[model samples]
Target: MAVHPLSALLSGLVLAASAAHANGDAPAGGEPAAAAQVAGLWCGDGLLHEFSLRLNQDGEQVEGELLRKGRVRSIEGRIDGQVLRTQSTKVGALVLEKQGEELRVTGGDGPIALARGTSFRRSPGATCAS
Candidate 1:
């Protein structure tokens, strides 16, 4: 069977994260890079449960290709102030949080919450706590 490119990339990212941990290298994001890119591609699988989302953010706008068991779907939303209001075309809307370098999608089809170390914020409208 052929490995999906996205899967391979996700796998590589996981390996790198693990290696960095073993080396005691403090991750740059320290929380998650995808949280703030605001205009880049992101993909991750929850440590527990079978959930993964590949999100892309553009300024205050966010949308991504959600993957479920080799199936790809779409999710879209926007960052409103400190809160993230989003909805999936297939699923629905969800509330998200931004803390440090991590942005967590709260109460949704993705996970109880899905978080990652992100490089930056979605846009200038939202700011992290001091």
Candidate 2:
């Protein structure tokens, strides 16, 4: 049997996070990093565009891949309090906050530019295909 590349990557990430936690290097906040609600696959649709975010959160640090307008880009950021802030050369900066079952893009500049209030839903079974 063969393991998917993404699965392998995520597994490695989980291991690293566990090791860090065991070493007393948890996130700055009082809450456990494993409690992060943004660590999952999310998707959103707009009037003219669709995007998907495959995020992995390890403590305050976040690493993920973003799919927007059929283009894919790797993104890295940190969780500041309740917001996840990510930056990419192609997309500038993106600030996301979890609201109930949605992850809303509170502020940011993407190539296609989503509105400030645009929200994404957790879609773990969804693909990045646009």
Best by TM-score: 2
Candidate 1 regions exceeding 4 Å error are 1-49, 108-130
Worst 10 residues of 1 by lDDT: 119-128
Report residue 85 deviation for candidate 1 (angstroms). 1.8
Model 1 C-alpha lDDT per residue in residues 13-71, reported as the tens digit of each score:
98988887666453455443233343443333234123344556666788875554567
Using lDDT as the measure, which candidate wins? 2
In model 2, which regions exceed 4 Å deviation? Answer: 1-35, 109-114, 128-130
For model 1 the local lDDT of residue 55 reads 59
Lowest lDDT sum, 10 consecutive residues, model 2, at 28-37
Q: Please give each candidate's TM-score.
A: 0.43, 0.62
| Distance from true location, Cα of 63 in model 2, Å | 0.6
